[model samples]
Target: MGDILLRVSSSIKTLIPFRSVCKSWYQVLSDPYFTRNLSLLISNDYSGKTYLVQVEKDLISSPTSYSMKDDIDCSSGCPIGSCHGLLCFERNNSETYIVNPVLGSDDDLVIMLPSMNTETEVPSLFPVRIFNLMGFGFCPNTNQYKVVRTIRSTLRVYIYTLGTDDSWREIEDLPTDRFTSCLPGVYLNGALHWLTYPRIESDDRKLEIYCFDVETEKSHQLDLLPQLLQGRNNLDGLKLGVLDNCLALYIKLGGCFSNFDIWVMKDEKCWANIFRISGVAPLSVWNRDRVEPLMLTEDGNSLIAYAEEDDERRLLKHFDVRTGKNITNRTLIEKGTITSGRRYTAHVATLMSPKHIMKRSTCHV
Candidate 1:
């Protein structure tokens, strides 16, 4: 029975129910060895799928059109980060949640995070303000899932371990200058990476990557490629994502130039310009300055993107990386307005449970 279940673990849909069959089956599915092998198999064999989470204008309810029937309603918050099929949301700027939206019929597993006092005093007219950036990721070394948050005003960082009694532990301070964007962090290679700018004293203002290792609770910086640094003024047009298990940067060259460039990090210090799409209409027509690279196609030939036009129409396009052309005529999403805080990211469902991975210590009061 265990061997049969292992064979079917490749499909996320099948693996979910398999764990519910019996106590022994649940244990087998949650085994560390089985979880690691299953993740690799899905990455190699599964064709990636993209889903859009739309937060209503009310800023409370969010209905996701992930599938025809999968509806996620968080009346208090908006989703900000996605990792390993778990969605992390920030509600009222004071609390957070980690939820698995695809667990059909079985009530959604929602983990409410303990509130933290992030308020700090600024010199402005409004003396007290709160600025926070949060990220969610899985740490393999400890087999635990963690949420990392950085308070911008004080540069203080806090980490919350899922299924553990630890509320939020203060970690090392962020070493970089104030991060320019409030964007969610991208999880890759057991770390969370965010785009940030250097301090005002520095002459070069081009954006750099700020990476935080989940296991070590440490921070590092990755410099931008020479080509990107040349156009420092256009930093707002840049976005980051993962492609083929590597870090990728998507930059839209606006104005008369109607195309965008995709650069993939080949090594720690090397970046390869993989694709350049020319004659892209959405680049010129979009009210938003940047377009996000969602995922690489199954065959690894085309790249999927999400962009918004001047009229606020959201578009999902498929660009053939090899030919640098928009090959697909069909629009994945039409006449849809993406909500302000709602995020759409690549999610591959898995049976790896946070409860099983997180080690319990003392309970929080």
Candidate 2:
């Protein structure tokens, strides 16, 4: 029964209320693995996920109305990424924070990360990563969570392990400084992959992506490209996101019209066409305005997306993925919330204590 309660609970908010139902509910919530398992469940389900609206003061952030029950007052931080129920915040250009929103509305759950370098914020080469190349990932092997950042101009990589490392440690830099800030650090299979900058020096045969393993702390390359991408106008449409806890590549490909095909990476090597949309939906276009629900739904037939209008306004849109059929479209996300400089991503509130990831008696970094 304890295991069943753990499985059925969607979010930390939902799971907590069940504690009053029975002792089994309380025990499940109290388990040391509760937050960790809850984070895993959210990744697997992807239904109760919240699209972060913006980060306010104290690194406290706001999610869409669907997920905004807790009014947290935080400031001076921008979102880096979200992983395992923790929101990564970049503040003051150098310091990073790991915050667990499920814990409550105060700064008690905030874990201040060590400064990477004295380097100031890199100027905006493109829209994203005006700060730096940053990502947050979970290593399932050792049950560890790590934050990875790369100095924008130098291409040098640094890593910080929660519950273990007291300071940020430098790692080997990428072979080339050319990397796309489009989809910064895409976490998958205990590793983070960064899409290389397209068409460097006009050498455009095919660009391979850079992969860094969290557990191994080493970098490698993955040739996970499809033949359709060889002659595409812009590689921006070919986006990478997590679906069913796997690396999913969705791009506009040839069909009767421009069709969007979602390919999932299997065994870390092969790509399988698991979902296909008959026509391109405007919301599915990936560009400066990051699209929410980045991929197809679990059923592989529908996608809930945010459509950007001509007046530079975004609207909540629901439509069929395969046929470009519109179900409904309206303004769901609040106005003035999803703005520039704020990185909006999906979030699942978790009770996972940020301190629990620490390995030492005291945090030095």
Candidate 3:
């Protein structure tokens, strides 16, 4: 019986559906040992027409057996927040809910603003036009959760703590010129970073970054790096991620091939030009003119841009901070024909090896 339990433990998530095998099996499945190893994987349906997929990692390796399951139903305007093993999802009408699909739990959070909903219409003022730019993070110091929503470049910041009667409290209304289009906000080092493109009437295109601190609930500007300022069109690029915990901006410069330049913030007021990958090489080709394509891998270590070669679709892959490359022809995912043109979103995670999970249990037991 213990041997059977051990085998079940190796794939706890996959074995969950088969817990009715016997009483003893049920006991083993309900044990803390099994639940502790369960990993929650989440990805959004960019069209907001389908429910997000939340699957247990234990079953993912055996893709044939572990089919990905939809965990949460999402609307067009709902913003998502991920922390620990749960997601903070809020509708445009201010209906907030904390859901942990893996645990089959959904907790309704109270409204953050006191009289705003009844006194003034939220949609009229702060409409949910774009869901991609909303920023959500957990603050350990306050034992609370925070969300940042931008409306046509203006920012509305909200925070919610556990055991608090209020759902979200609006801290401030940020100016409109500080927010960028299609760029996502990242929460790191107690602050939220947003990429913005500000242009004056007679001034050249001044690309800037706006940062908001969760502690102080204040917004400040970080100095643009020289290389970032020199880029042909920084706004045309996409927000990659933070390198070494600093904000990393990926600029797409179009020439004979697509130019990818990475700029990292060196200091609060300064930035450093980190790396640049130019031209389509034997390993990786830049898709200079592709529509609705460009993927950041699950680990954030690789960038996959869709390109074409000899009438066949290919993906130009760059790994290890955009160095060491390969052109994989296999399609990670393929979708056809959609209704409304929604913002492009990517959600992927590295699937752990079953051998690694076995080793983890051996060390624990």
lDDT tens digits, residue span 1-365, model 1: 65666555434455767677788887776554453322210000011122323211111121232122234456555455767656676666568776655452233356677986666523233211223457888776666678876544455567887766457887765543354455678898798887776445456666678888887888888988766653335555677788888998877755644777889898779999999877543232234533556666656777766654434455555678788777642233322333433334566544555443444312321
Among residues 3 or more apart in sequence or in different chains, the pairs in candidate 3 whose N, CA or C atoms overlap within 3 Å are: 110-167, 111-167, 112-168
Best-to-worst order by TM-score is 1, 2, 3
lDDT of 1 at 137: 85
Measured against the true structure, the TM-scores of the candidates, in listed sequence, are 0.74, 0.71, 0.60
Estimate the Cα RMSD of every predicted model relative to the unseen true structure: 8.0, 7.5, 9.1
lDDT of 2 by residue, 224-311 (tens): 5657554224455566677667887766544324566677788568988765545454223333333445433435555555445543
Instruction: Report the error of model 3 at residue 135, Å.
Output: 1.3
Highest lDDT: give the candidate number.
1
Cα lDDT, all candidates: 0.58, 0.56, 0.45
Which RMSD does model 3 reach against the true structure?
A: 9.1
Alpha-carbon runs more than 4 Å astray in model 1: 1-19, 23-68, 104-108, 118-132, 151-154, 201-203, 229-233, 281-291, 308-315, 333-342, 351-354, 359-365
| Total clashing pairs for each candidate | 0, 9, 3
Candidate 3 structure quality by residue, lDDT tens digits, 184-209: 46666676677665433334666666
Give the C-alpha miss distance for residue 304 in model 3, angstroms: 6.4
Candidate 3 weakest lDDT stretch, 10 residues: 349-358
